[model samples]
Target: MRGNRVNPNKPSLYLPCETRNREFEAKLLLACHAAERGWRGVVGAKKAIDQRIARLPRGLYISKSITRRNRFILDIGKRLGHIVTAWDEEGLVFASPEIYRTTKVGATTLTIPEKLFAWGEANATAWRNHPAFNGTPISITGNPRADLLRPELRDYFADEARSLRRHHGDFILINTNFSLVNHFLPGKSLYRQMLQAKKQPISQYGSINGLALHKVKLFQHFIEMAQAVAQRFPWHKLIIRPHPSENLDTWRGIMAGHSNVAIIYSGNVAAWLLATRALIHNGCTTGVESFLLERPAIAYQPVVSEDYDSQLPNTLSLRVSDLNTLYMHIDNLLQGNTSGQETLLKKCHAHACQHIASFDGKSACERILDSLEPTKSLLLDRKKPPLVDQIIGWTAAESRRLFKRTQLVRRTTTDSTGYQQHIFPAVSQSQVETYLQRFSTLLNRFHDLQVDDLGDCIFALSKQ
Candidate 1:
């Protein structure tokens, strides 16, 4: 925690990303935006942040979530005199506000972040209504993730999207978000893990179990849908992209004999959505992204529950409850007959406007940077942690690191790094530089931003 005096010349922003495919590009865009404003943006894998927090320069740390585990990390950052702020990655799409509050946010975690960024007015209102809210400023600046779907930044994925189209021509992308029931690590259940972490009460067992059952039903339905699509349209490719946390082997095993189907879990989903003919999902975040991208999105819901289904994505999509209707919608969408799509998208746009910001105005990256302006001077003048506190914080971080390593070693379910790679495969310095260059070309900005490799899949973006 102990560090040298503040540089003052250029403030730093530490943006840690947990899942690479989901968060990396958006955070990188934010980092590039920060650098353009004369701030050094340190962006990297979340593990890198945890390992280097004690030694890194104190700055404003923008966390991806405020779960209890994240609260511990934020505690360390706070001890090190780093300003803390966060917006839950899972906050935008959920079954209900109450369930989200119970399962995703903690009262103690809420106390750690100095400020909270909300995806939209809905999330801001939800957080404000939470009993644990301590009057912290909540900015309804939207999420940078949403910024990627905006037309202005869609070219960021042009190369990847082109490659996808070249390789998997006219594919129907099926995105599944069922990690709660089917996790990458064997025997791992996100539901049980949440309960074990005290994120939910024992009283929530029934509700949580019901949600898990609902997802299982949806998962099975997706498999059936995939099979049906493969058989129905043998000429077209049926690509199944499971949630990053889901077991890939299970999918491969299930679709073993299907020659037309492929299970892929790589790259940012934006590219896939761009390349696909149509996106079929139940209630995934990507459905909303597809709609925003003006792509055809179909929500195949064989079973639905008011209490368990996510509202926004489903409502935003063209939903069909049966396989025949799903096939018909797919056929119509693929053949470019968007007969009912425009009206649906118009209504969905109005609906999405209530839940998402940054659809028509300045990008969320700019909005977030604007919100952070008032904190820059404070961050520049921030003092270092006292030696005693530094020692304690360092010791605690080391102990926790060792405990996690020991647990990883003891696990019999998967390889130590398998799940990590599945979520965020190692990123290279060249990849960061390439994307930064792409951003510069696409937006005619960020030309002065320089990248420095900080090891452990981390990089620093700053003005050269």
Candidate 2:
């Protein structure tokens, strides 16, 4: 019986019962098993990757090499099993076992600069080639978060409005933007305290962007701009919803002098746009969201960053940095000179949006309805159990393989070994180390600073 023999009563099969019925997921389960086996390493590394994959927010995983996340990706797939599919250009590895065009999914802007995405895609070849990834381009559908724009979800928006009605006879909602500097700063804190600061990069080499450094100056600029708006206009109510990931105290401190400003932290962008008549942003993605809803938007600080210039929907930007110009632009928008900007913004909105999110705000809700169809059951039809041991082994192997490859690459490369005498760069390694040391001491004071998430790093900063 052991020598390639099968008992007629129960035959050995490649796939599990679920895969044939579900489509491709059985294969995924096996792949996940393989990955778990493959991720052999010091307990810390495996644990970290495992936790990160599980902790990442629900919605599409938007990495070009999403598969490269390897075990991490598989873990998410397995945990959220049947609820989500691994999306990529091809229907190969981690492809949804059930294929339904109607199932709603949530999506965030998956853009990662073509250069970065391409590099990641090339680096993880094994994950890229998995059978589930064979579909060249699959529609993962629209963002579930956008459901806030739907009439059903608009109640949340209405409540926000009612809160506004009680506070002031008239109000304005100014959505924030993605000025790289502003994105990094805590709005509540910067407004409270005016400070000039610079943070040493985390890595001397490869630290273009990953959320380090405080955006104090930019927030100061924004606070000043907002104050100018209130002083210039007789507006009574103003709700300043900084980005969700901001420190509210910073914004509150800035507005401390004036009692007129209110703060609202919302998880939904579309709902906020609908509740307001006009949108104000310094070229944030919310500008695009606002445009999709046909709301008038004001984009300021036209030259300082890339926000105002992209194909995102934006009514009229001040197009200049002068305070007077900004006031005039705000005045014109409040007075309804919105068409000039609206037409252009609509074009940008339409162009930018059509390619990425083809569905409206109800995309996620609508997508969820398709779970019942047999032909498109997500991954159910695969009728196969994946080779769990192989996948786990592969994951472990890849991790070690990558570490070794990195070590090998580092050994081969030298950064000007012969030129030992040169002027010290303005931003020095020692400076950063000193800064990090101070931060570590700061982080040690907090009980929760133990976690390694981005917020944990910030918590660690507060102690300093």
**The candidate that achieves the highest lDDT relative to the unseen native structure:** 1
Error (Å) of candidate 1 at residue 427 is 1.2
Worst 10 residues of 2 by lDDT: 455-464
- TM-score: which candidate is best? 1
lDDT by residue for model 2 over 1-464, one digit each (tens)? Answer: 00121122211111111111111211222212222222100111222223343332222222212323343434433433212233332211111212111011111111111111111122123223434334332333433333333343344345555655565544567765323333223332322232234444334212222121223334556787777666666455667877643445656777766667776654345545655545566645566555545566666653453321332333223244667876665566666676756666555644544433423443432342232123222223334235574355356545644554444333222112111011111222233233233323432422211111122111001110
Overlapping backbone residue pairs in candidate 1 total: 0
- Which regions of candidate 1 deviate over 4 angstroms? 1-8, 190-201, 204-206, 385-388, 407-415
| All models, RMSD in angstroms | 3.8, 18.0
Q: Which segments of model 2 are wrong by more than 4 Å?
A: 1-73, 76-136, 146-163, 177-217, 306-320, 333-337, 353-356, 359-464
Q: Can you write out model 1's per-residue Cα lDDT over 1-464, one digit (the tens) per residue?
A: 11122234788899898899999989999999998887888889887677788788778899898877677888878877888899989888999887787778887999889899988888888888878899999988889899888888898888899999999998988898888777887677666456446564368444876676677678777788788888998999999999888888888998888899999999999999989988899889998898888877898889999998998889988989998898899899789887566777777676787788777787888899999998886777877779887777788778767766665554434335666666778998888888888878888988766788878898888877
Candidate lDDT scores, in order, read: 0.83, 0.37
Residue pairs with backbone atoms closer than 3 Å in model 1 (clashes)? none
Compared to the true structure, candidate 2 yields what TM-score?
Answer: 0.48
